[model samples]
Target: MATAVQKITLSSSRDIPFNKLVLSQSNVRRVKAGLSIEELAEDIARRTLLQSLNVRPVLDADGAETGMFEIPAGGRRYRALQLLVKQKRLAKTAPVPCVVRDPATDILAEDDSLAENVQRASLHPLDQFRAFEALREKGKSEEDIAAAFFTSVNVVKQRLRLASVSPALLDVYADDGMSLEQLMAFTVTADQGRQEQLWQAISDSWQKEPYQIRRMLTEKTVRASDRRAVFVGLDAYEAAGGGVLRDLFQSDDGGWLEDVALLDRLVAENLKTEAETIAAEGWKWIEVAIDFPYGHTRGLCELDGMAADLSAEEQGTIEALKAEYARLEADYDGADELPDEVDRRLGEIETALAAFDDRPVIYQPADIARAGVFVGIDAEGTLLVDRGYIRPEDEVPVAEPEQNSDGEPATVAVDGAQPSAAVVQRAVITIGGQVAEPEDEDDDAVKPLPDRLLTELTAERTLALRDKLAITPSVAFQAVLHKFCLDVFSRYSSYGTAMEISVRSASFPVQAQGLKDTPAAKAIDARHKTWEERLPKDRTDLWDWLTALTGDEQAALFAHCASFGVNALYEKGDRYGGGATPHTVEQRIADADRIASAVDLDMVEAGWRPTVESYLGRVPKRRILEAVREGAGKRAAQLIDHLKKGDMAKEAERLLAETGWLPEPLRMAGVDQTATVDATEPEGDREALPEFLAGDDEESPADDADEPHMIAAE
Candidate 1:
């Protein structure tokens, strides 16, 4: 009633002489790939034959079996065995395990070879990882595994690391739910729970880039290249029992430091030790910190000191370095490029000469007794010791003249009616129509207005005068320009003009990382340097040099100096809680908008763009979505909104990069908005505006409702 199953005959197995197994032209493999023949031969010598070769009997064209066999499949294995014979590691007559096929079969050798190569499944990565881990658990060292498997120790370690990941994630990896690269990223952290959590979070998101995974895993950790970590050497941190997370798969820039608190402690201890050593040099005090705000020395006085003179031997070394440098330069005078060793030797000479030039400064004992040093680490992780800064309170007080009974200065008379040189000056002082010093008030006479009342009255008059001066554009500009010039050029003057205004370059204590290396910052620095080079070296000559400059030059210099005073950075609420209120902060931003509008400031043109480190990664998920919505449109925002904070931020960065969309603080008020609108509004969605943007309805409150108040403060 049923069709019978036909009985199939299996290929017979037997031992064959290595010398008799000949390569067949019907072999499917041609190009070289994994594991060279030499390495394979070495592997065979260690493990013997793991897989039996497939061999077909050699026929004599008469359809009869010959004494020898030809390999249709496992050609590489045959070659490896032959290589062992050639090396005398194996006997030519040594028996190799193989499956022998009949010479009378209808199957072609090529068909057998193709089927053997194509039908077989290569070992799964997960399986290999587990196998390596199993070997590791059995007391095999990473090196031993590598040696046995013909792989690198790093490869073995990577495989073991992969195996150590969360079993749940491992199942996903085995099912092809994640890429090998993504799995590799999870190895950055050893916490299996965290690995599983991250996988679960991004499992549904469309943005599971490896970098994003690595970022999420190591978000709380500090980069080993961070200044603090660099200062507290990685070796020292490890010695202190602090852990470090390294990414073997990617260039992690020395990887991340897992224990941030421990690192900070080590850095502090190291910094304090350095400060104490510097204190031994007779400095009055040492201010230690990880970093000081820019312009920290603004109000302080820097004492001038002479460099220590070179000793006889030091002087000879300097001459020798200089001579060697000159000889090398002359030897390669016009060569396209110097020889590698010659170039290196020249660099050494230059460095030696520079060391001689950067001699230790010799400060006077009196100066050292009053001045202090600022000890911190620079951006490059080098010890930064800014010495000889004299705080205002530490400056030597100038002796004051004797005051009369009525609090008036008693000027010594040089002659019958003239005052001494101390009292002789260009300007005469008057306060509220009275002399600089008022005569003693009399009880019988009507007392003059109180000093407080006089101050109030003069303040009102000062405001009125300012109003008038502001209307006179030419005079106002001249007055401000004159003040700037005097402040810049009259650093050493004992007396100054009556102007109360000053240009104080603002310092950013809290700024984004890499702010100093931004294009705008670099351009400003280059411009400042150019002007500094053009200016006179001596302060006394500054005024004369300015006077000689043409009108355009003067204006350019004025603008450059004024640019330094611009402060538009967003500060935290109540940064100056006691001194500045929220209203003042809001007004400051309003005024900055005016200035920005006047200059037509565009942050996008200044080379600012949304980057993870600069903005997206630092903000909350809701804010990131909001930024993406505004910059890259709603569709793009929705695309990544479901992602976790870390993944969303990275995707948003890619989406918003070219949109030229800026945050509220960076956008200038009164700037043309057509370009921004066109850039942000998706094509064909321009006319289909959102209700809020179209002014059709009131917008709902944001997830972070406090943002409005925070915005006002910023």
Candidate 2:
């Protein structure tokens, strides 16, 4: 055990003159990789050299050592140092640290070179990340680190972001508990608590992914590119102390704005400011919203106004631009490609022409006094001002003064007869744009309103009315039953009017924005979803499955399916029609009353509450006040009576939040026949089911006039 042991000898180390070193043919490195020579040279200039070159002394033909030594390894490092010498920053006589092999050693130069290049391990990625963090902590900017390491600035930033993740997760990553991609996901958010929590939540589940982490962290946020954020610029949002969660590792659609509520408030405030500016333009009313639905002014009248006239100089400039544009276009018309200058000149001409079109419109003082304007943001975030809209109630009345030939004021005839015209032709006294039906020449009889137009208007009302009715399943079922009975009985067909009794769920012709988010709408969506899940998927299996349902399930399902068929629409009554006559409408009402009495459908009890979008917003000021007065009492109505319709609607909504007041159209028209019925009677679960399809996933179509159809079990 005490026997002498031989000591291992490593390759000898020595300093070699830069001028004496020359290219070694035994060197294995040839192709460029990692850092290029130029970048490596820059790095060397910044911080001497990281690795020393491996070299051996050159041997002459007689086995004698030559003055110059041939290099065997670390060729890149040699090139970098040589480049420094060429640039005069380093001297040729400067000695570079190197490892030298004994001239008599049996090891080949190529083996030494290969061993120097391959024997060492690459730096661990985590070590690199920590190194970046250490450099940042040591007062070095990311830019400095990137330049010194010969990498991109973004790469430096990404590494810093990775380093900033929670230490606990970082430990897990270091221990190989997660992949690099997953670690990258956690970097989207800076909150250590959130990062740790999300990892813990999904670590055991199969759903743990970087994208999922990002989604969960930003589910409540608005995208930076969202319209609301676009309207409220990101600079303003951040100034308001709102935060944005950005992903440095992946494209996040410009990242998510973390404070949605702040964004909404900013949007509202900015919109209000925009409204104020437009209001100063002498508009009778100004409507401010993020967006106005197409045909938002359906009931409003449009005023005709003239565009402002162009000045003489402006007109002459436009003419000149037009001439230039024409010349450029004509010259390039047949060319395969337009010349850059010609294209640029044509664009200039177009821009000049467009400036003229932006001139203001001229309106009469009277029209301006009564006309309203809509101020909203367009899809591109540009301010949009739509002017010259007149409400129906603002129409002016034609004035007439009464004076007789005897110089005495004449009174209008009480009998509603018109005076004779100058030619003795029968004078027609019509007002309010009501045109009486013309007499048929063949029969010389007064004809009724055109059946097509009447049906169209009735159809409009029927759909709106039906939307309210379909939500009341009890009422819908009974209404359907009433029609079924009428069709079967075939009783008294005499003295009928032209109205239809069809309950085809009429498509909503118009709806207020965000109406689908109301409590009632949400509840309906949830209910519909419940049924959708409960029912069998295949239509062929529906009947068998329905028959197999329990009594309660059957009753609920029946009510739901029947609601689709319940059409309580009031089409215009024709004296001679195919459907709803005046008499038929009366009968339908009587039948609807019976059903309302039997099931006791109270809209207030069916998860419906009045909100601006659902009710108050669409009505006039008078209607809003009336609802508040009835629901929250007169004091509440008085508090907001002085406000404009829009403001009044908002105030009224808050006041009536707990009040179960419904619009007259949505109220049960049937008499209280169920008040005296036995309380023990079974009303089924129709009352519990919501009015529309249920669940957040069940989106109410944006088009209110989407084809009228039921989400039936079939």
Candidate 3:
């Protein structure tokens, strides 16, 4: 048990001549993997051999040792050295360091090779990041570091960014508290405090998705591709003291501008310069806005202007283009497809021809003096000048001016002239335009209803009729079929009293904002697009196309065409002017209800809710209280009644978010009572009375004698 231990000695290492080393058959590496021999050769040439090769002395058949040695492990390094020698970069007799194994040892060459390759652990990613950082700190440029290692400059930069991440977050990453993707997302923002704050906010929630993190980090910044940023070029933005946030790890759509306000100011300044240049054209009171609303010119009179005539040279150029296009088309008429060069030439010719057609218009001197232009920036960042608008008051009188019998001027003129042709140059701001067209004044024999009232009434009637006709598909089909029969069989029957039935869609004179982007609208558009793609291109082929379809297909088409007839737009009924009687709107809505009940339609299902911006905030304190009372409970309503309108609306919005309660117009067909909150008072507690009805509404402290009352109130 006390026997002396024998000391084991390592294999003797020595510098062997490169030419003397022979490749070992027992090295065991066959297939190629990570680094190629050529790259390895270059690496060894750059920096001499990193690890010593394992080798044994070669023995002759007589058992005497030769001068040559055989390599087992580090075979790749040996091959690299061999390649270097072949390339004349290394001398064949140059000395190479290696550990020489004893031929009498029990260890197998294959075991030694396997152990050398497998026992090494890979460098940790964090360690690599720090290594890159240390290299940078030691004055190695990113490019130099990238070249030193077989990596890209961007890869080097990413590692450096990761290394620069907060020590705390790096620790978290090292401990496996976050993913690589999340860490990359944090690189979008360099502010450590902001990054940590965002992480804390989302770490407890499920909102920690990488995209969500990126969005929150850049929420206050403007994308480089945004119209405003694009208009104010990045160079100009930077020159104006604005900073940009960039993501080197991924495509960020040109990255984000850090100063949104500065970008906006630059955009506005550029727009103003463009407007000022356009204003030099002698327009009458030019109006400038960042964007004109859809119906910005609703009631304004547009002056008819003629497109500028092409000059002789321009006309000749267009003719030449057409001639060349015709020659090319005829030459390739029988070809299955035009050659790319010829196709591109044809496109150039077509564009040249269109350029002449799209020339700017030339307005008459008088119209230009009396009309104005609306200048704005288009979505493409180009100046958009909508010319030729005459405001209602600025419209010139067509009738001859009244003559004064005593030779006195008929009208007062601010310019002190003969009234300046009955037209005026003025700047009148049309605030919140009334879209409906007005009626004639002298048609009292049967005075027409006010435009707004008519629009409101017709809107409800249109929706009701669409609902009724949609559900009664058979009737709709019969009506259309009967009309078609009359058109084909009796061409002379068009003048009869029988209604000329056709789908006349009602335009949206007034619509809720974002009506086009709603889910229902998108669904309808997708369905229309599907049918449009299936339909014939030529109108003449439509009848034949329809006739070839099955009955089900025809009915489906009919329903699709009919659905466009729905119009439920709400408009102000003109309380200040002669309009349809007040009850007419109420009656139309009631009829719509009857039709809606028949079809079992629900506005809630059609995508509508009482949000703070959409409904609750727009209403008053009283309406907010009413909603809370209906949706939540009387006690909830009383609780918020003491708050101001803004606070009350926000609270009510939260209260009604899940109740599914709707305003009168948005209510479902047969729904009467609103859903209630699932809550109750504790046992032995009294119901809370309305603040008005309670005697202790003043919130006064109670006396000893009144303690019982106070306890009851509580």
Candidate 4:
């Protein structure tokens, strides 16, 4: 049984005059928001009205329809049109599109207004990004797009960058799978493949922080502030066809240099050029490197050179700069802050004065003939040239008289008879270096046992003596103290000592960036400075100073000095199989372990956290997972095991940060490996993961082989 369908009719629409349309009191919108009336009016002027105004016929008190209508919805558009009219941009009688509802309709004007404002969905950011990209593709410059949208050019560029991300990642973003900040972080890098790869790695992780995303993206790149980059100069690097990655959203401190190898080459070339210029001074040799180990001048003789005299013109310039500096300082003497220009001028004056103060040193020709120079760049990116160092082998030889058996000086024969070839060879060898005297004729005597046998016997005796010394702490201490006393009290280091103890502070030529700023390094430096200030200024007074100290003070000083010689660093073996054999490496670690055990050294207590830059970031995903498993527990390891190498390392850094977990190399023998766990908690409870990590136990789907290698989820 079909009934006739009732037809529905929509309200009639018409172009109402701008003057005839009036604002209704029933309009719900009162507070101002979004674009201003002027901007909206400008937009309407740029591209006519986008939507029709909802209006109703105005009725008199007697129920008669008036000639005008009242707008309930689209009040903003009405105001915009009125503004245009006021500005004489649009006529008062302009035809404004409208939909007229019946004067007697049941719907209230407020209802219509509310419905119009609430029912319309705001555009998604992704849409805006895509729209901007589309505009750019349509032959519009970034400035054009910005002007069209009433935004800054930088904003337009950022949107474009976001749009340029991997389409797959964009899809994920469109699905509300990531935040705007995270999307912005991905724009730090432009490799579409890398963007997709990283997203897949962190998409399921619980710790997908925006900063983590940025760090992972730029981990392999060198920052512009890096010493190497600073030394090579970013402008010059770019001129050499190198690319730089910049972050437009946040301050990147000059961004990052994309081509690290190119930067290194430029740095090397510039350093070599500087070295060549310095070599013009007639140094016997110039040792050039990016950086030298600390205390590199040990055992080298340094020449005492005088600063070069300034030229007449230079002296006048220096005086002028100093006078200018004094005038500026007096002008701003008590001010809270100086004006930028004034401050800048003051800085220039000071620098000019410093140039005069740091005049080049003048060395004697004789010293220059035997001395060498060390050329490298300091941490501040300035060329550092250390001159007048004389190696021991380069020193002038002193003449000595050959004595006869009767204790009188022997004279050389003036006769033409030349010495035998063997005698000549011996004399030539003596000129090269100190040589062993000719062994007394012992061929007839059952020759002192074979040289090799004698060496073996002596080595055995040395081992037995060391074992005995180890048991007698007092004797060992006295022996070390005696060596130190001689070193300090004796004027010449050439004096011989029975104990082969020379406390040479180890230098870390190869180390992580910012190692000097670490807490451990800082504490050691402060301690060294304190001792340096307390020591006697003169070497001759050092013996008296030591004698006046208490026993405890002496022991403290001894320990401090001995600490400098501790060498626990691991260096790679030579590639050609020449140095640092596997056995030697093993032995070094073993000895370090023994020393660590004696001192009860806990690296965790030493403020060594597994940060991304220090440890995790440099290692593989496997090592990161292993660290997490050992430190945080198997559950925490599983949480991030699915992430890519970068994300995995970052997440591992977070999980293991306070756990006090250390790598095997940093762990001491016989120490509890899992001591990082909270001591008050029960042993069984330490494995419980953090609350944030407690989530659906179900494992996420694994990524393909292009992702980091994954362990099977438990």
Which of the numbered candidates is closest to the native, going by highest TM-score? Answer: 1
What's the residue-level lDDT of 58 in candidate 3?
Answer: 92
What are the models' TM-scores? 0.72, 0.58, 0.61, 0.64
Instruction: Report the CA-based lDDT of candidate 3 relative to the real structure.
Output: 0.68
lDDT of 1 by residue, 348-466 (tens): 88887887888888888667766788887777788888898988987984235579999997754321334422211111111113122332221222222233322322222222232
What tens digits encode model 2's per-residue C-alpha lDDT throughout 1-714? 698899989987878889989879999888777878999899888878777788888889999889888888888888899999999999999998888878898989999989988998998778899999999999999999997888999999999999999999989989999899999988888899998988888787544667667767887788888777787888989999999888998788778898876887787777777766665555566666666643366577877678899999999998888888888878778999998888888888888799899888888755665677777766566677788888887777313437899988664421233433111112121211223333222222222323332333233223333334545555655655555665667693422211134423333343344334344444545666689868776779999998888977766665555544433333444568765566666554444334544455555665556776555655445556667777776555555665556556767887888767765434565322221212443556533323221222122211122122111100
Off by over 4 Å in 1: 1-6, 91-93, 175-179, 197-209, 397-562, 565-626, 640-660, 668-701, 704-714
Q: Which stretches of candidate 4 lie over 4 Å from their true place?
A: 30-32, 58-60, 64-69, 82-95, 168-189, 193-220, 247-256, 324-352, 380-382, 397-608, 611-650, 657-714
- Model 4 accuracy (lDDT, Cα): 0.69
List the pairs of residues colliding in candidate 3: 450-579
- Give the Cα-based TM-score of candidate 3 against the true structure: 0.61
Each candidate's lDDT (Cα)? Answer: 0.69, 0.65, 0.68, 0.69
Worst 10 residues of 3 by lDDT: 705-714
- Identify the runs in model 3 with alpha carbons over 4 angstroms from their true place: 1-8, 19-33, 57-70, 203-206, 326-346, 397-566, 570-714
- Segments in model 2 whose C-alpha atoms lie over 4 Å from true places: 327-336, 397-714
Residue-level lDDT of model 3, residues 416-454, one tens digit each, is 334443233332333223343322222113222233433
TM-score of 1: 0.72
